[model samples]
Target: MVEALLEARNVVKQYGTVRALQGTDFSAYAGTVTALIGDNGAGKSTLVKCLSGVAMPDGGEIFLDGQRILLDSPTSAQRLGIETVYQDLALAYDLDAAANLYLGRELRRPGLLGMLGVLDKAAMRNGGAGALANLGVRLPAADAPVGSLSGGQRQSIAVARAVAWASRVIFMDEPTAALGVVQRERVLEVIRRVRDSGVAVVLISHNMPEVLAVADRIEVLRLGRRVARFAAGDVDVEDLVGAMTGALEASALGANDVEANDVEAGAQTGGEGNTNGGNGR
Candidate 1:
């Protein structure tokens, strides 16, 4: 097996009395997608916070590329080539797609002023266009205002940025939640490209079909604790839902199942009446 690009062992976190995570063991391979599934408040967001360095874990360790390290802050995770695209997609609506693509990490020409210098707009445009093509995503234009683009295009920009910048792991939080049919497919296609390029992907999604379609493995987070792990081929969507909902036995499926349960369904996902199911995207 390939070495894990990111690994969390015995990880625990708390927000006063809430206790968001309880000693979770999670890992992702360099060229595969791992879906983190749960009903809600299953510590999915908290786990993402810890993994992305948004918050520090109260205990346990995180290892990247086999080296145990401390993620005291998001900057640390970024410095180590870990990046995340949140549900908002984090784009500047007023700006064009290319502009949002390089937000904060803008390309600049060699001039008297460093960051104060003018941006290399032509280069950025070309580079951003290339990145979209490289990921097999189709959009109207690279210069289109992000606000003017379709839901998929905006999501594509966020995903394209993560792919363009990351070297190891990319965490996507509900990437397809607010997109249309064609748009959602485009986003999923981009995800496959990310994995194909050999980057490990951690997807926090409520859409089980999306998870089953592309994930090589599924990890269930219930009430902030990882309750079960499933190989993509070994478990069906019903089983996954059962696992996520805390209605299945640890040994529901033989051999391939690793059982864990210190937490139950503390949260409900965006599917059903929840309505934010990015799975459609």
Candidate 2:
């Protein structure tokens, strides 16, 4: 609430027939990791696409540090200092770590006669490696082809790419998805480093344990709508699942003020009826 670095409100997205996202509100402050979690089909992907500028929302407004702005394209988002690291990473497997790191923003060195026909390979190597380290990601070697690296290593490279160029908020989609235990931890460590470096991070993940471990706040979406939000320490996994499943409202978590209907439901359920009959049913 201390003036978010990035704030999105009432964002809506739709396909020709499918309304993938409904009105939604989300924000991430500087130096914090805001995790967005939900069950499958909870509009997580659609919301992420809108935030990343892959798909512009048909409704709602977005603000950067209290200033309303327009993001019509991916380049527009980048121009606003919002960088995104997708699950696939969009990296070229054929390239090495340094090459992959500088995929779009390649380093160039001036050649003789002012004809710069050379890629600054040395500079990229050193700078890329240092950036990776800054994000707490240690690659085996900067010269190693990205295709040869393990899933975790590749993820680390992808996250490092975002942090290295992002001057504001970084959106990470499943940063540790499919990674082995050690590799997952490594990716999480890098995410934490990014947060500590003062960049706001929006992490999209299905891994609740990982979310619980790294998130400073959690947002839950259900039926294509944002149903709840809570400070990390103020809520538990169960509360998040309740919001995602439509059993809880925003107040069920840490909301200070409860609406009339929300209060009535709370009275009947004792604020715990969201559970599934105490069984998996």
1-281: candidate 2 lDDT, tens digit per residue: 37888887767676787767656667789999999998999888888888878887777777898988777777788888899999888889989988988887788886662255678888899999888887667777778889999877887788888888888889999988868887788778878877888889999998887898999988777767666666777767777777777676545444622222322222322222112112111
Off by over 4 Å in 1: 113-116, 138-141, 253-255, 258-281
- Estimate the lDDT of model 1: 0.79
Winning model by lDDT: 1
- C-alpha lDDT (0 to 100) for residue 134 of candidate 1: 79
**TM-score, cand. 1 vs. native:** 0.85
Off by over 4 Å in 2: 111-117, 249-281
* Clash count list over all predictions: 8, 0
Structure candidate 2, residue pairs in collision = none
Error of 2 at 222 (Å): 1.0
- Model 1: per-residue lDDT, tens digit, 1-281? 56678988767776897777766667888889999999988888888888888888877778898898777787788888899998888789989978887887788976755458788888888898888787676777667789998777788788888888889899999988987877778778878888988989999899999999889888888766677788898888899998888788555543556333322222222112113211111
Worst 10 residues of 1 by lDDT: 272-281
